[model samples]
Target: MNDEIGRRLREAAEAHQPDRDRMLARVHRGMAGTAVPRRSSGIARSWPKVVLAGSAAAGILAVAGLAVAGSVQTTPAHPDSETTLTVPSPSETPATHSPGTTGGTPPPAPGHPNRTTTARPPAGTPTPAAPAGRRVSEGPLSAQGAIDPHSTVYWAQATLTLDVAEPLTAFTVEVRVTQNGGVQSTGQWQTGPAGDFTVTAQESDGAVVYRWELKPGRTVPAARHTFAVQYNHTAGARNADADGYRVQATASDGIHTVQGGFTPAG
Candidate 1:
């Protein structure tokens, strides 16, 4: 029996040898085809993770950018609630004074060492009082006079006698001459002493006018005062065809006034 079994086993082994070699060859070929692409497939599978990491990094960068922008846009808080800064415009700002002294007392001149500075008087201030003298009586002034050298020539002279009831410190005299219904000349004189005289002559309205201011001064007592006046024309004579010339005189002692006049011979 052992002989028979042994022979049978040997025959079977010999018959299956070719099939086994063929099967082994097919398995090796499949394994070679699958092994070549394994590393590349693994790398391809990891690409999603790389992309996700890149997206996450970008998200972090965006969040950081937003935070920086928020910080830049925020306003600084002030410590004091009531305090605020404001800038003044050109029109609203007050003008600065120049680098010099303004109105008040002026500086003394360089050469005037002893000069005194005087303050300006207030508005509507009264004038200073006059010198020491008693108030004179308010009596009318008296005058008696006629122009002298009564000729038909171009020039003439006259004497006037004035009287005042009270003495005066200052006096004023005015003389007016007229001819042919028109004013020919006017003269004014003022003096503080006695024996002050003034003479004025002019031609107007086709006639010559002469005026004189007699002694106007304080030297005249409360009695009579005498003075002379004259008139002349350089270009023309008195109206030979008209009536005599007219003369008018006025005198004032600041408190009293008198007026008189006489025509000279034509």
Candidate 2:
């Protein structure tokens, strides 16, 4: 009876004994069943789960290590900041117009023939009016002076005073200027009531100048001439020349006086 009991005890010990390789083989075989059993509470089934979990953790760590290795290998090869960059050529984004052309016009090639452009003159500009107005002569009436051959201008120097009965606020008077028997008179600016004003003045280039003014404006004119000469010598005039060109323009309550003339003086 003792011998039989010893043999039975040895068989039980061998049957229930745990071994490392055996546990590992069981776990590998357990995967073919493809799912590890969830252990309720004991180390009996937990060893297989432990083996599988260890292997799975090792696989994950290996894959992560490979990814880190690959990143470290590639990151340093390319530059982070480039020193130079290329720009697109002009042909890729051509201009819409030439230097001065409007965008609405056609964009012709550099040497291509383009349509001619024109500009129209501005509107409402007036031409000069013919020179004709009231003329008077108190002394040496109708005396004349010749223009420089370079500048075709004529002047009349005479002294006269007319009685103005109207005492005009503003009115037009006439002066008939005869040069080489060609009668021409420019417009005159009216002087103020009972005040002295200029009849005419010379221009910078030795041209005849016509003067006019309304009352309370100025003793001298302060406006541009709408009537310009055909050939302008718009300077070098004699407005206060006592011997050759002198004018005392006066307008009173009713009468007008113009005192000026060309005397026998070079």
> What are the models' TM-scores?
0.29, 0.18
Q: In candidate 2, what are the lDDT values of residues 40-156, reduced to their tens digit?
A: 233455776777776676566555554444444332345677678778899988854333332242212122122112122134422222233323342212223222233222222
* lDDT for residue 232 in candidate 2, whole number 0-100: 20
> Which segments of model 1 are wrong by more than 4 Å?
1-140, 179-219, 234-254
Query: What is candidate 1's lDDT per residue for 119-233, written digit by digit as tens?
Result: 2334553322211222222364666545544522344444456666655554544333434332322222222232343444444344443433344442344676554434433
Against the reference, the lDDT scores of all candidates come to 0.42, 0.34
Model 2, CA-based lDDT: 0.34
Backbone clashes in each candidate structure, one number apiece? Answer: 5, 32
